[model samples]
Target: MPTPTEIRLKRAERLLEVAFDDGSRFRLPAEYLRVESPSAEVQGHGPGQKVLVSGRREVGILRLEPVGHYAIRIAFDDLHDSGIYSWDYLHRLGTEQAERWAAYEQALAEKGLSRDPPRRRGG
Candidate 1:
């Protein structure tokens, strides 16, 4: 498996830029990473249990912590921090971004969902 040689967090762009040892580079959007989280809440315990996450268009990473030597534990502004994105998984998400994003959008449209969450009343 190709490991990341560099991982940069582009705060202004809300992107995670990863450069692998294989000379492959990917700029993964915050929304994409949030929706495609590898947590049980998102991925579930078995196949076909994948949950389609919505209302995260403006989500941003709060921080990213290294999980051992294999993965990254991302804390998103939405308070979601369960997913542990591994090297291979991250790479796959980057490479298949287009198809996955299109599928996500289609699913949301079918479910009458929106990327931006509903506005809340005065607290």
Candidate 2:
């Protein structure tokens, strides 16, 4: 497996650029990362329990924390920071962006969810 040589978070664009040692590079959106998070909250404890996260089109990454030598913890602006994105997983996400995103959108549509966050009343 190719290891990541650099990871750049473009705050303005809400994009995460990952470059691997094998000359393969990918630019992933923050919304994609958040919805497809590898955390239990998103992936669930076992098979067939994955949560379809929605309303994150405007979500931005707050910070990236190193998790030892294998992964980094992404703290999203929405306050989700539990997912520890490993090198392998990030690569997988980058490579599988299209299929995964399509699936996510389909799932959301099936459940009647929107990419836009719900509007507030008083605030």
Give the runs in model 1 whose Cα sits over 4 Å from its true position.
none
What digit string (tens of lDDT, one per residue) describes model 1 on residues 9-110? Answer: 987889999999989999999999999999999999999999989899899998999999999999999999999999999999988999999999999999
What's the true lDDT of residue 101 in model 2?
A: 91
Error of 1 at 59 (Å): 0.2
Q: Model 2 segments beyond 4 Å from truth? A: none
Instruction: For candidate 2, give the lDDT of residue 56.
Output: 96
- Prediction RMSDs, each to the true structure: 1.1, 0.8
- Roughly what TM-score does model 1 have, to 2 decimal places? 0.96
What overall lDDT, based on C-alpha atoms, would model 1 receive against the true structure?
A: 0.94
